[model samples]
Target: MTFDDPAVADELILPNFNYLGYLAQGSNVAENRINGAFARLLTPTLAFTIDSSWVHQNWPTGRTSGFDKTNIGLKYEAFRDSRHEALVSVALAWGVGHSGADAPDTIQPGIFFGRGFGDLPDSVSWLRPFAITGSVIDEVPIGSGGMALAPNATTGRFDTVLSPAVETLHWGFSMQYSSLYLTKRFDGGPPKDEPLNQFVPLVEFRFDSPRGQNTAATANPGFAYVAVTWQVAAEAIIPLNRAGGTGPGFRAQLLLFLDDLMPALFGKPLLSDRPAHSQIAW
Candidate 1:
């Protein structure tokens, strides 16, 4: 499950060594898959990501399937402000074409932004715990092209080449209510017995609009429990329309902070030996 942090534009997540994996079975696609991803910081403001998946699928024609191509991306923090808990970033992702990597090759460029509501007034302090994060991406095909048209029904003769594939735009929006904000920035302290104080409840919406194709969208509601070294989350995936899916799906994640586990390695650049100045804070 995913909840975009309101301060997501801040890219503060870069400091953590995070790994999340999920298993999914789809009603509309007739497939079962396992997907996993990891993100690591390469520098103070740069990060790299690796994502892979295994899929078992059955097409309408009774065809079987296997693993998908691996995916990788690099992101850079373009702007940040610790005082505001805000950040802006840009990233480029690619589907690596290799054996067992059976998905179409593509390149996606994405931009992200997020901000918290810690600057609100006392009258509306309740809403001050809320924050929002958003992203926009453009999907561009790289190598899946030069396709032939269907053969004539009667003569079975090959036709002309198929038209070039169209591009698509994807967007995501997430709203989060941070318990950390409630206790730290709010006027009153939290109830000592409050079990959910560290849990951030959030909802996310994702949309895909393809040129010359039906659009797809999904809404996900979930909660994330933030901790000193890790976090866990689960959400219900609700399709927005038939194009999105026939029914709901599900998502879950276990994210780890590498710096917490291996401070010397994950806390600094792997390519460097110099001592860095990053440290944890309460």
Candidate 2:
């Protein structure tokens, strides 16, 4: 089945996040995922993130398999002026799988670059809030026990992703194209001999209150943002030359500042008089 099918497209989200989970089904396989991640702003210009996820799948024949993955990364803003800003980031990811699946666990390293357009008013800015990002990743096999089973499985893969995104006060959208080319070692050698390559497109909507300024000239904290996302994908597994079917997917999420959550979690009233930094969907 192709990942582009409505069934598959519904499983991915863009502008990504710190935590996520999903479930999907196709004619040939059923998949489930669970993930947790954290992102922290180190300075006005630097940020760091850590993420981990678990994925499990069941084939039509009743065969079940799964993998666990962890990733860490840092991002730095390279240039910022009144009209635009550019940033770069790099990440390292590790993976391990159970069952006899040759999904050979591996370490993948990648780097990404992004640029954003600024200089528009908040109310109408969503129309031109554009950003473009791209990344190249390398995967290297690891561990011993699993290797003995899929001895012919390829050692790893080299992949890349290109994504472009835009957002407004009430909506956001993005498209990502990812390609994975496996090496001709282990068992499957080369892109023509393996199941690889995918394309995904995502759309989202955010609901929030109006923006407000802070006193003493402090930075605007912005209002909380709540959003829902929908995605579609098309995937290919070579060698067999058989086209996989496609699927649809969806996600619902919310983001609030730590300060907002603190009072709510402690059963205190949300400060009623604070100047809103951004619109928030109540």
Candidate 3:
């Protein structure tokens, strides 16, 4: 559920719960997925997160569905400065290995960064709405149990199974234009309505490549409506190559800011029962 964006969750002081629905057409049947993410702030520069997904697979002759293993992670804002509208962060996560699920006790370490043009001169204030974010991660399997059935040399038959996993790379980047930031920080006149002022046109790229394996990627272009307590985003998924997918797809999501919806309760950092009296600037 994490989009590999540096400024994710930086706009508010609250925790978030997001639900996403996905759809894609395959060679024979349609594939669908349901994903969710729960993120909580631990401090001004730290956060905790949990993510999971369920998939519905379809084929010409058969169909199946199952839930993927849950992934738990933590993120630390390594550097930040609102004056420049920039931030840097690092994260680590473990995919809980489970039978009938996914992965093999996998670990992912990633770096993220985001920057905006808000600090530009007034003559180019319009460009201030533009921003960019990116992230890259290393995927590793803990144990050597990722095996596939292979032919046994001694027996001269397919009777052995050998580990098949290798180090993989997961990466993504995004370009966005935040209407909210443009008007709220740079404009002289009042802004538009609540959700309208929060529009952000975004394009995201996600890719993966395993050692000695083919590379695959997906590009998503869409707009998001961000609000104080919630957000909704929709994107059109396009394949970058043959390995990416067959054709265009789509994904829609709804996110709820628990902190804003119930600031007196869930909005505060997890380390403290109540919101901090003094804000920490980074």
Estimate the TM-score of every prediction.
0.75, 0.40, 0.79
Estimate, for each residue in 1-282, the C-alpha lDDT of model 1 and write its tens digit.
Answer: 332221211122322221212112233235555666666666666667766666654433343445666768887778776456576778888967553543357788888888877767889888777888888889887765434233344654435555465578888898888776645444433346555546788888988888887777878898888665667777777877766776766767666667666676576654444433332111
Residue 114, model 3: lDDT of: 81
- What C-alpha lDDT does candidate 3 achieve relative to the native structure? 0.67
- Give the alpha carbon lDDT tens digit for every residue of 207-234 in model 2: 2111231111101111112222222222
lDDT ranking from best to worst? 3, 1, 2
Q: Which candidate is the best by TM-score?
A: 3
Better of 2 and 3 by TM-score: 3
For the record, the alpha-carbon RMSD of candidate 3 to the native fold, in angstroms, is: 6.2
- Lowest summed lDDT over 10 consecutive residues: which window, candidate 3? 13-22
Going through the candidates in the order shown, the clash numbers are 7, 36, 1
Pairs with backbone N, CA or C atoms under 3 Å apart (clashes), candidate 1: 6-132, 9-87, 9-88, 9-114, 10-87, 17-258, 69-101
Q: Regarding TM-score, does 1 or 3 come out ahead?
A: 3
Sorted on TM-score, best first, the list reads: 3, 1, 2
Q: Candidate 3's residue-wise lDDT over 1-282, tens digit each?
A: 236556434232222222223222224445677777776777756778777777675544455567767888898878877778778889999878763464478899989888877688999877877888888999888876554333344654443355555788988888888776544443522264443647888899988887886787888898888665777888887877766777777778777767657766665686755452221111
Off by over 4 Å in 1: 2-28, 58-65, 146-166, 184-197, 271-282
Model 1 C-alpha RMSD vs. true structure (Å) is 6.7
